[model samples]
Target: MQTYPIPMVPGPVVVPEAIRQVYLEPYGSGDLEVEFVELVTRTQRRLKAIFGTRDDIVIQSGEGMLVLWSALKSCLVPGDRVLAVATGVFGYGIGEMAQSIGAEVKTLGFSYDETINDMARIEAAIAEFKPRMITAVHCETPSGTLNPLEELGRLKHAYRVPLFYVDTVAGAGGVPVLADDWHIDLCLGGSQKCLSAPPDISFLSVSPKAWEIIDAVGYVGYDALKPFQHAVENRYFPYTPSWQGVAALYAAAGLLLDEGLENSFNRHDAVARFCRRRLVEMGIDLFPAPGAVPSPTVTAARIPQGFTWEAWDRRLRAEGLVVAGSYGPLAGKVFRLGHMGSQADKELVTQALEVIAATLK
Candidate 1:
């Protein structure tokens, strides 16, 4: 394997040295408790700010997918129906999770490269199925497409039957996520994306409406905490939490807040635009559609014909750049460059594009 001078691929983007300094502090002391609790609480608040919601946040001990499954199993019952506005892999997965939890899943699946066109179909399905929840991925990373979340939220509200559950795993920090204004019920995000932290930490914000629904049902065995009463034990995971991931997540949230939410979104938006502009200047075609509909957190491009995907991957890797290949059906046909985390800067993105141009020769 040849090695280039630059390290490519998004995340595990170079962790900042200052954030790493948190682990240097002593642990398991009374002081540690104060620091840890404050850190977690503050991070939750910062997440609320980014989500633009009064919804309560839960810092779960696993990947965003785990938290996502938790929401499905907790809110839905055996006979309840769920409507999923699916455009890509993650959106499909949300529908599957609802199905696994015994809910009847009804998906309005769109082509991989396109956004969900049939909001009317979604509304019609809700009316036909009378579903209790609507699951959606705010940005479908697999296709690099952004769904119309505000409109979807509005539709769910109008239907008055199903609540909206948003998976903002890729879109939270980089895109505008107005959970309150949009009337989103449950929203989830991960630390590894725009927060520029490690992958283990993920968060979920539950609105008052969600609580009412869940309270009417029962408890979610995984990470259920009692909000109103002191007698109920807040059941966290059966094991100790990831201290390092938590500390890094808190520090990353602090960094994100310091940067400010709007600034963070604009930073990612600008980088994504730069990438698209450079691609167009190079005479390379993007996946399709307007840049606005594409995910601001990632860019997916068609691999040039006649060149094998593996050859291009090897060429880029030899130059120390590591972009992602498309999944499943998209494999070999499309390549993805993540703009989240530390790669959310123009310098890094330009360096990546430079590597690609050179590799093409």
Candidate 2:
């Protein structure tokens, strides 16, 4: 496989040597190894701190979508009402996933270039729909926008919503995801994005309310969260666990904690701001709507007028610079530059931007 010299894609970021080194050595079986369970617990502790939650953290062996499906299936039964608040691709797609599982979903959608800020409209939806769950995406990577969850959380609490699910996959480590304060029941996360690890592990913070729903629903499948709920205590897992993936996750989470999450947030914020400023200086138009808040993890900019997305992407690739293209409606019109995890370095971003500048010339 040809690895791009510059990795500015949205996920599966270039893993640092510190995180990758653990995979080089051999480890014991995840099912029998007491240390593996300890590793899982320890990683969960670190993730809880990062997520700003006291809720139980469930780690599984798969990519980010694994836990996303797990959370929805575990907590909801067929015909359950789900109010999916959509601002972009992932936000809207998650709703479709719910529908696939037989959920009677009402998608409260917004423009692709915007974030979820219309709380009054959302509250009215919640009031009328009386959904069992309210789902949202904290950072919509495709559009490079961040939705403020504090107000939404307050609404969730005030309305007595049974569950509030959020996918903070792209923003968990580099951004603030206060699960407890936000009254989020299932705060979904991934290893690849801001966690600075390979894309093999998935995790989520499960609140007491979410656990209750999981128990009640009794969902059984490969993606079910129930098995994980007691796996540690029982010294077992649903399937053979990958010690390498868990170990990598442990190291990655530790790195974030050591740096202090606030510092990570500041670094990502500074880098993203700089990235946007430079893009604007180069006469590039950003994709986020005027009122939408841009994410600290990724920047989505309009493809320069003359070049088709295919040609622009090919040019960037020829220069050994690889960023991501937008999905859904924004496809072929917007490109995303990820600056999260190990790729969040300012120097790295500068180099990538230089390549972009040269390509656009």
lDDT of 2 by residue, 1-361 (tens): 8888888998989888999899998785556989889989999899999999999999989999998899999988889999999999998999999999999999999998888877899989988998999999999999999988898888889989999999999989999889999999999999999988999999999999888899999988888888888999999899998899999999999999999999999999999999999999999999998989999999999999999999999999999899999888899999999999888899999999999888878
lDDT of 1 at 271: 91
Per-residue lDDT, model 2, residue 188, is 91
Clashing pairs in 2: none
TM-score of each: 0.90, 0.98
TM-score attained by model 1? 0.90
Q: How close is candidate 2 to the true structure, as a TM-score?
A: 0.98
Question: Candidate 2: worst 10 consecutive residues by lDDT?
Answer: 25-34
Poorest lDDT segment (10 consecutive residues) of candidate 1: 227-236
For model 2, the stretches where C-alpha displacement exceeds 4 angstroms are: none
Relative to the unseen true structure, what is the C-alpha lDDT of residue 137 in candidate 1, on a scale of 0 to 100? 88
> Which stretches of candidate 1 lie above 4 Å from their native place?
1-12, 29-35, 223-239, 290-292
